[model samples]
Target: MPALPRPATGPGSRYTARAATTRTRPTPARAKPDIVALARRLTARDLWLTALIHEHRVLTAQQITRLAFTSTRSAQRRLRTLHHYGVLDSFRPLTVSGSAPEHYTLGPAGAQLLAAQAARDMTDTLWRPTSTGRIAYSPWLGHDTGVNELLTHLAAHTRHHPHTRLPLWLSENSCARRWGDIIRPDAYAHWTETTPHGERLLPFFLEYDTGSQTLARVEAKLPGYAAFTTATGTAPALLIHTRTASRELALRRRLTDPARDLGLRLATASLDQTTDTPHARWWMPLEPTAGRLTLTGLAVRWHPLTPATGLEATDADTPLTLPVPPLPPAPHTAP
Candidate 1:
């Protein structure tokens, strides 16, 4: 839930925008935004972007492009305009030398605009945002943005494959509400891939990691997944996305470890690094071969979790079937 506005000294208010940060030499004139021009240029998509950033908290420029636009150039252009108009605020994380991509969150105007767009009442008085210093100095900012990138890629992927339905996408915060202390994933989603035989609903928990997480640390999360499934008898797959192929390889060992038993079926993949698009070729399984498989094809690799019933019927005369839990509610998008 979005919090009410806080005092200026509030350290980490999600609803508040930070003091403006200058990328280069200070451009004092840019402080005052051209609100009128910005309002004139706003699109429904722009308002959607505002709502998205509001929901997810922060997004890098690349994630925004994948989520809302066809290309990075166009997305960046709009982001710059939004920032200039004080509708979106951003800061770059500390890099070794070269510049880092700007991370964005909803600005005061953007949040208010989104609330109004959603037909929600806005009665708060102190509408200021988090301080720029707080965002820049946040320790988990990079990790949070990495999770956003993974979810954004999944969100974008479904857009291209009309047959693939992303029914329920719960953010980390949303997951916290749904699962409480039972099992909190970086993101939780139910994907239904339509096929001639029928469709299969894949409920999975996302554990997106940058290169920073050690394999041991990765293994530590296994018990939680196992416990969740044991308690609910609803064993969802665990999809891990890492920064590097090496990291993916190392994590795979832990995921498929023979020594320690883990309940959740697991698959691993590297972050989508090639094109703006995501494809089956980008997803790798535990101890996978050279050829990659589509999301549902992953079922072949986790037989215990997804027991095969037989060859899926290709013709209308034959109906495809699988042994699994009762069909889930028709896929619906989570707010």
Candidate 2:
């Protein structure tokens, strides 16, 4: 017999090679649900129940009802709804000694739903004010100005309490008040206790001076805040100068002088320009300095202010002396 014909090395081999390559490729992961849609379905009660099941694999309907403070009927209804939604899977034994308790466990879909809900909640908590779709109405506060930058930076830095709580007192129009409006500071802050006369009900008063016109406009409106505070018993006044050499210093003196007078003293930070570090971009008290300076008062703790720096030159003075490689010749086309 003729030597078995040698297999042809051509298109047949190429086809087999391509088929193998295609089989080796990985399938992409499934995407999670739409955040808005998921959030809409997540009731407070649902969240509570999901958390309960996540902590314990097998929970009785009665146990869930007791923990959630619902009647047996309500609990059963919720359980049935969750079971229908594929949030939970249930099983009932064929033989029961007494009244059979229905046991429930989170299904794969339920676990995924809970995880997605947790991620969305974290994101919502982080960027609260701006995430809520409210615009910054203080026209005097410019876009990307020092205060706005500070607010954005604080939003990131103060994700937890103390620093985080300060934002609750500020609003879009927080700084806006007619000439005589009272400055109502947050009475809840322990810092307000340091003020003389327990006048925590009064406003802290803030004023921004853009120019002579702005100053005159604010001066006319200041009394409204004072009258409002007196009537409501909430302190609500502060005047912040947008531009002025002694602005911060003057404010510090006014705040701290009374402490010294009362003999129940507090230390104050000096606003000396020469002592100003680059981190002094805003008037943040140096972190936990000695003595009574340790108290942060109503001020929010921000990240250490970092100045923008320029990139260093890679090749200084001398030219790049290494010879460049020659280019490949252009391909010739068949005539």
Model 1 stretches with alpha carbons more than 4 Å out: 1-20, 23-42, 71-73, 114-128, 258-260, 271-278, 282-292, 300-335
**Residues 142-257, model 1: lDDT tens digits:** 66766765556667777677787665565676566456577667877666777786777666788876655556767777787777777766667878776656666677666676
Q: Name the TM-score of candidate 1.
A: 0.68
lDDT of 2 by residue, 254-328 (tens): 444332233211222221321212122333331234232222332222211111111122342111111111111
Question: Where does model 2 exceed 4 Å of error?
Answer: 1-147, 150-167, 173-205, 237-241, 246-335
Q: Specify the poorest-scoring 10-residue window by lDDT in model 1.
A: 318-327
Question: In terms of TM-score, which candidate is strongest?
Answer: 1
RMSD of each: 11.8, 29.8
lDDT of each: 0.58, 0.33
